[model samples]
Target: MTRQAISSYKQELLDTARTLRQQIRAGEFTSTTSGLASGLMQGNIVILTADWAQDFLHFCQLNPVSCPLIAMSRPGEPLLPELGKDIDIRSDVPEYNLFVDGELTQTRTDIADLWNDQMVTFVLGCSFSFEEALQRAGLAIRNIDLGRNVSMYDSSLATTPSSRFHGNTVVTMRPFSPADAIRAIQVTTRLPKAHGAPVHIGRPDLIGIDDLATPQYGDSVPVHDDEIPVFWACGVTPQVAIRNAKPPICITHVPGKMLVTDKLNDELAIL
Candidate 1:
């Protein structure tokens, strides 16, 4: 519910990277990336060896909804200059989940020690970007308001497969009144990079989710009597691909925790 107790770095361009990297390097700021860096575009990270990047890249292209490619780094290069002036893929992110052979093995703050010449980092658009837009329009996101991670569920909807990468789609759920939900849809539709619009709304059953209270990942937010559940294609869907690919080594940001980019959400908005 609270950000790490570490002191935030001074507010400056260089300071931004310094602070962000420091927190990540220090094992602080390991929680979700939601509501942090208010105007920044947050990304879902997927790092794999170059040998596996081609297949994963193809998978993302085939399943754009769950894997909107934002920026990709060359093999072994940890710097993501496209996202920020001095971004370090190995340390800027708050937390990372390491997967070996499609199974989650470890979670850590930085991947510096694990970095290799064959590693390629993929930055995928995340739902957090549109969340700022929705809040700016005065819509209350239950997860943010409740100070809990957004609820994520693995759905029965299948994503287009690429070679070894294949799996069901994962979605993040938010509850909104019918009217607010309509506005949210309109507001979020502007940011295609941020999942665009709701894939499903008002019916959890349609997505094969049997219970609203039990999510496959992240925290569950309460749904009020009049509110309906609205679902957005989540960047977390890649985890399923990670499991399916069973790559020798893969690294990804933990659920909720994401890479904060310098790009503004408004810049990505489609008029």
Candidate 2:
């Protein structure tokens, strides 16, 4: 536990997005948002100075699978009207990672003091938005059941480069039986905003992942002999790009922790 883990996930999981945001805004819930706000869309957050916003936007556009852009705020402005009526980019997420010169310098509950006229917040659609759909399709999400953050890895596959951002894609892994994975794919394919479907299936090594026990981000979950590993493009891909681009300062949601938005997942899902 890097920071203290929140209790009552089961009870709290049913909280509305606004309620959850209030808790997050108040600094009461600082753990992962993996299982909260069921049926609603969650977003991956990235805040950068005006100087780097355009290039980062280009990076996201180049790799839509990993960085599905949903909403963005004007420089120095903290409100994202598209996400929620009262969504404040400065304090709505549970935790934030502050990067200085491409290195993570600190994690904070809020970034109000750091917000400036040059800051721009970009919200990318998060894969957690599709978990309820997976459940509706009868697929089990392992990490949620195990009370842990999902496993994430850096693949050998490189992202399409932008003017100043280039790095390998970051992926989140979920293990499912052959039958369930097919259903999972079908269910998620309708929600392109949620990173869509699995990018790779089966052998982890083929994608350059050496082990399942250790991950680049989040907790590693168990993969049974009966199941295969399924990978999806993750929003954290931008964080990797940030490292390569070396911006003076950047603030992003800590991995697995996200901005739980007012919008419903069904609104973003294609029929």
Q: Pick the candidate with the highest lDDT.
A: 2
Runs with alpha carbons beyond 4 Å of true place in candidate 1: 1-18
What digit string (tens of lDDT, one per residue) describes model 2 on residues 81-192? 8777789999999999999999999999999999889999999999899988898787889999998999999999899989988999899999999999998899989999
Question: Which parts of model 2 have CA positions greater than 4 angstroms off?
Answer: 1-15
Model 1 TM-score, all chains together: 0.93
| Tens digits of lDDT, candidate 1, 120-159 | 9999999999998999999998898888999999999899
Error of 1 at 106 (Å): 1.1
Checking candidate 1 for backbone clashes, the offending pairs are none
Model 1 lDDT, full chain set: 0.88
**What RMSD, rounded to one decimal, does every model reach?**
5.2, 6.4
Candidate 1 has its poorest 10 consecutive residues by lDDT at 1-10
